[model samples]
Target: MPSRFRAWELCALMLAVGSAFTSNFAGADEKAEGDIPAFVGKDSPVGAWEYGKERGEFWKYRNEKPTATIDASSVGKYADKLTPGQIALFKAKPGYRMEIYPAHRVCGVPDFVAANSEQNKTLAKLDASEEHVVDGVTPGVMFPQPKTGAQAIYNYLLRYRGVGTSVSAQVTAVSPRPGSDEWITAVGPSLNYYPWAVEGHNKVVGGGAILNGISFTYVSPAALAGQGGAGKIYFNQDAEAYYYFTGQRRVRRMPSYLYDAPQLGYENEYLVDETGVFLGPPIDRFNWKLVGKKELYVPYSSFGMYRFNAKFDSVFSKSFVNPEFRRYEPHRVYVVEATLKPDARHVAHKKVFYLDEDTWIPVLAEDYDAQGNLWKVKEAYPIPVWELGGTCDFLAFTQYDMATGRYVSDQTTIGQGKDVRWFAKATEPWMKSDYFTSQALQSRSDR
Candidate 1:
């Protein structure tokens, strides 16, 4: 219905309008760039990428992209020799240095753990399918020479921690404001039970259910007294949690308490799964990649941090735990990166875990936000439990929230004397399965 010239004019106008709209859209994106925090060091690669991508930027470096690997010829005497990319990934400051020492393979499991691991390995090899089954494996390290990242994670999950351990430990969660040494501290006692670690009980018990259990009851600051909870981890599924409110006098089941859930009175920075660096199975929520081996300055053999005479105030320093009592040693660690799946929901978009090769215990972890900014750094200090035939255990650990400057320290037995104790073997009556029951929790609280 229109002339050729008129049609041409209309097309020109439409193109002009489209160009203007695109220019405006691009301008808006440029303006929004300011909202993103300035990228530091090698983080510029991540700034250009959008958050919540199906495959995160860290996954790009999963395989051969990261050419650096720890070996006998590599530099290992000092942390200063670490690559800039490595330091940047850990969010360590420019001047930060870690004193490296000779690698020691001091991790030793009990006879039971060694025997069980051998059996588990055989069972695992028989299955050719990719389907991950919980019941097929026994206790101890599931896969000693783990080829995939998921297998390495499973090894950590099943690492030898003795058969049923009972530990009385204290948690010191400190929230400090800027320009003040004053820190609000929440001190409390916690009890841990590892039902799966029970000796002579290799098969599944209690109607073929329940794996591990923990109960924590705060006994300090008056306001938080008698306010704590208990949680049970299943063999194949997520954990079931319950919180005790002193006022209500009832234990309410909290199914939503798994993964990224905040610990009470800890400023919501420390997550349930973030405890012990990486807790529970991460197979479903994340795509794990084994970044290979690297010599790292990780907290190891830090028995001094658990001294009975050490005072909490002396050990607690501004911004971080005191380095005097903390010991760092050079150890070959398997670097594993866990990027959140697109369907998974969590505050931490990416997590980098450093696991000791000898023990398979996570020694250091870096957590990143959705915006790809480093949010928190966690360190676990390992101490060899001599009574358990040199079995290495996490003596104490700290999680630092970089943005908020708040931190949480758990498993601290320092200065608690008789109130806190770590035993290689569980105490006689407490080792019973009935001791971890929900009914038992209510009855114990009543007493």
Candidate 2:
């Protein structure tokens, strides 16, 4: 996913005279254009981009309302197999469809087991040591109990939608640590969707080359909401490229903003290893479970009843990720789970995620401790804006300690406005690495 700040920096430079962002494709399906409303940009805050009211309205206008009712009993005939009810649901949503088949029987393989063979052998040797060791008389901190094997069930399903690669993430606690406030930030070349933090100068910086090596950026402030100047932000790549915002309004022009739908991985299994590095290969080896469909009120995006209880694993019956003895409620999205290759660097033993079906967005995630307990829970959401084509322009994501109250949430893409020319020519010369490096920032001193 393009960095939120990088997109903002590019959006700032493309200042067109009028409010309407011109169509990228001439004769671009008037139907597609018609599907979206006109000139909603001027009335919106500059940096608000994650899908919001404007895009939501377009979705509502273009697509027919789905019949919200479903026959529960008939859902089973297609539980492991595609049934007629499942087909009906898919037909109701535009640009959407469903692929239902036997969970483990598809490739003529036996059902995928969450807590069977290999996983136990691998997890058996982990140090079942204490959660934490404290100084002097204070008792050592006890981390949350390890996750039950159920998370493996969750991963087996979510992997089907993602590139199934090792995504990058960082957990941050407040300055003092273990307080009421915290944050978390996760980024990939193709997507950036996280939860908003209530307060703080939670900032994150990251970017890479676009078409022709034009680099990008992302940033946020300590406190959001009503704060006046804290969120001040901008992007500059020489005279040909200038993108910045005075408070909320944008001023400048440059190409290489987001909305380009850049690819993050080379193939389904390879993380795009060019400018940005993939931690590892695609997460393809797994036993999967397609739990039919259901309705879930996830963080940012909401859709009609869709697939539910999707789960998966790394290789075969091994379950070393979320551990086998942890107890979690059924309603909690703890079922969606995955494990990095045992040897992959910076990976949690098992990571369980609660995902939104429509957008393939992860609302919450559970990172496991060495002993397989719920180490941290990560949350994410985006700010809605029009100039960004009615998508989230800002994103805030946080990770909290499940046992202790410590946590951290990084905020990125927090600014406003747009330059039409820069947006249209997104993916250009100025957005390269030399323009945004530390040497560049240190050499020039003016905003």
Candidate 3:
């Protein structure tokens, strides 16, 4: 057998052992069914709620109506309806308005995703312990009709973002200084492999027990060229990451690349886990609360931004990514609040996520600082990939730092050639589990 296959086999064995232990202690079969709560607005079934030591402060279901729903064409006319924070971030330009339309269920899951979701629902009832395990999930959305915040998040976590995606993109950071349009950009190639989403088992390239693998190598801006990193995220364990340094001609393990670590020297504006709106593990750090469904204006089906001839200056303006190409639609979103645990430590104290009901992808997120004030607003521009039979988000996302006026736009194809594309299916034969290891990082580096 090949060495890579043997490594995967060993990984699978370890996962089996881990699952057994999880089943025993995690109470995989404990059901949280009970009388449905009398929710006010859009009533949905309630799921399990975990309690914190802070008495009377535990997170609970908060089902309520949206503050206001306006048309995207008349967003400025009803500017008073928006919160102060909303107005500041979405300041409308002439001939453009942030219209909030009627809500619709536009998200559609693929058959495989639906099948896996049904299987996950059954497994959750049979062994509640597997509720958060991503390794054993059968290639689909984990919780289709999520009742709790955690379950809703799991839907995003396990959402089918393609089995593998390879893109040559760019990351641009705009300086906060006034009258300074100076921008620092990093051009690179990014490969993301979700082993858990791969169909069947291919010992050479399939992820035996891992959830996802990502590798990125910067190819431009001379100084950052040759700097690369690879990481593997497990279903029930801490993620493992490694960084390749050209000077040393070696790869070094970077265990601290979790939570709020600055990503690729983006001036601390972007965190490692903030990609794709909310991408990291959520069960342990934050106590999530499902705040019910609300109608909101969010970016949806933005096909214009994906044009091969799009320019960076036209796409990215001074204050915000020009809203001209941004398409907004009214959609019922599952509002989830994540509060930093008292025991856990992080920069953001609170985060409110707006997940589209249809796609289960976070469209907008408001990050609060230590003082409980809105500090950063993150937006995900999702477009439907017709070939994939579902919506794919974050083709271009902007992270705006309210305090600093600086923002970072990652995974953007603006300015780069048309080589940047989202593959609905895995096309690369080398997208295997072994290809994301630290050793692979060293070998792939162009030193």
Candidate 2 off by > 4 Å: 1-175, 178-294, 301-336, 392-394, 412-430, 436-447
Q: Could you tell me how far off, in angstroms, the CA of residue 248 lies in candidate 3 after the best superposition?
A: 2.4
- Score candidate 3 by lDDT: 0.61
- Considering TM-score, which of the candidate structures 1 and 3 is the better prediction for this target? 3
Worst 10 residues of 2 by lDDT: 102-111
Worst 10 residues of 1 by lDDT: 37-46
User: Clashing pairs in model 1?
Assistant: 163-197, 164-197
- Give the per-residue lDDT digits (tens) of candidate 2, residues 19-85: 2222211111212121122212212332343332233333222233322222343444434322222
Cα lDDT tens digits for candidate 1, 264-336? 6666766788766777853567878889877666777665456645687777766567655666665566888
TM-score for predicted model 2 compared with the true structure: 0.32
Query: How many clashes in each structure?
Result: 2, 72, 11
Candidate 3 residue-wise lDDT, 1-447, digit = tens: 112224464455445444222110112212221211111121112343122121112112122233344434545776633434455565432332353332323334444444444445544321253235533344555565566777777767766667777776655545445568667678788888876565432222122356678888887767788898898876656789899988888999999988888876566777888876677663577887899876566776554455435677887776666665565655556789888889988899998888766566788888898998888887787754434553354556777788887777777666665534445566787578889999888888843
Candidate of highest TM-score:
3
